[model samples]
Target chain A: MGRTADYTNERCSVAATLEVVGDPWTLLILRDAFAGVKRFEQWQDRLGVARNVLAARLKTLVSHGVMETRRYSERPPRHEYWLTEKGLALSPVLLTMAEWGDRHVYGRDKSPVLFRHKTCGCAFHPVLACEACGQVVDRRDIERAGPQDLTAPTVGEALDAVKIAAE
Target chain B: MGRTADYTNERCSVAATLEVVGDPWTLLILRDAFAGVKRFEQWQDRLGVARNVLAARLKTLVSHGVMETRRYSERPPRHEYWLTEKGLALSPVLLTMAEWGDRHVYGRDKSPVLFRHKTCGCAFHPVLACEACGQVVDRRDIERAGPQDLTAPTVGEALDAVKIAAE
Candidate 1:
């Protein structure tokens, strides 16, 4: 427990994202949103989560722009939750996690759900590719450029220029 | 709080994966491994984390086959941690989270350690495609069919023929 509870100490993007949505509940809530569940009660029902916790997670996600709130009905001002562009960007993360789970945890059972690439017409395997190249990356290909670059080019240029993979 | 903490409670693959590596430090440790930081002290130095927490995370990852432990040197019996093939599969998840953080937390100033497609020489965006037509996917185009497949199959099987996407 001596480790600082403050997750901000780590200066990595992965850590930062975890600080916000790494919790079990947060990811689950996001899953429900993708499943088309929006109303507060609906999220609570599908997830079987505590009302208070669901409320808090929803507030945090909305504030963080991982999700957005809109009125589904006008009379009483009822709202529905939807993934914003930012939230939709999380599709890869969620899909990857689910695929991993399917392999290790659900080894014997069929993947109750599968992610199909609408274009490829096959089961989608989420991969990291070099935007510059189109190769499937393996280890030993990436290099360590710090979050800040240390070249004559301003740190911004260096940072922007970092293509860890061929891309 | 009301949501079941265990993934086995649900049949979802994402839920299953969370049951194992969903803890906070697990992925961080894996991230360090991918970055080529393997020794316990190096991990501590880079992560600025408590010794016990790092040890525990390493242990969990190894036990789950997400990581492997090997003696770095003979004299001291000192060991280094490394990712297994299973562990390497996490690249997509890590990339997704990193991209999410770069967008939300870093905004324009922060950017992903660009991933290039070694073969293509362009920035690669992992697009979910249709297995049937090899077309890119949008929400309106697909329907869910769970492994159980108790529900009727709609004609527009544009998406993967998995379980119905539960609502």
Candidate 2:
């Protein structure tokens, strides 16, 4: 299949994020990283992904700072991939995707993997909640603002805006 | 680029879900659907995606029951695509992705489009929480279990297991 054009110039945040981890291969690779699979050969074996493709995806992740490489052995110069904070934050996305699949696709009563809340020591389903009011957020609660002026600010400006908004 | 092999036979719920919505283009189309872009033309205009690819994606979503086409005009025989319940369930996935982009990719002070918790009437950020105990779930709280038997059960068996587990 032909690769789609990059969304580098797109102002949508989703598009921007997709630029980094939107591809299925990339997401699957991240899934393995979260599962504690590190070595290159391990990813290839577990995912059954093409060697070149896996190599490419890993390289992209490292370049984007989602994953970091560490040398584990000196004899053969072995390296392993690990998730960074930014990458770890993607857990919600993965969990939610799995939950959806379990409910709609798998028709399963329980998920293949269950998530436990360490603080409470109970199995839990992840949900979206409002940070300000701590209320669950639904589709009806969201709307696109500045729809006509969809051009998003540059990354620096966005960071500044977030800071100001926080204040 | 060659397409990755399908995970249709995979027993993992995540892989199953990826089989449906894992591709970047497919996910992007879903994102547009959530954003209220329904018509084929509108999607083309907004996404700049190839016509054949867009058509294929729309067809796939419709076939999977994520989207349904309704005739809006009989004279011109035009149809508009709308999200089904299963499709609407994907809101969290899209929101999480956009939120990720806002925080990491854009470095924005806030998301370009803000999500409001309509029930609470407050701007919100989505968070993962445990359903069993209602505690917030952190990265450290999660671990993969039954790694030796990664294969998940069929729908019927899974449902039965869930019921038993509940007891």
Instruction: Choose the strongest candidate by DockQ.
Output: 2
lDDT of 1 by residue, A79-128 (tens): 88889887887876887787676655554225667655544455655545
DockQ of each: 0.28, 0.46
- The recovered share of true contacts, given per candidate in order, is 0.42, 0.63
Best by TM-score: 2
The sequence of per-residue lDDT tens digits that candidate 2 reaches over residues B1-167 is 11665565456667766777777688878887887789999999987889998898898788667899999999989999999998998887888888888778666445567655667666556787666655556767865543534566643454344346546
DockQ of 1: 0.28
TM-score of 2: 0.85
**Which regions of candidate 2 are displaced past 4 Å?**
A119-121, A145-167, B119-122, B148-167
Residue B21 of candidate 1: its Cα lDDT? 72
Clashes of 2: 4
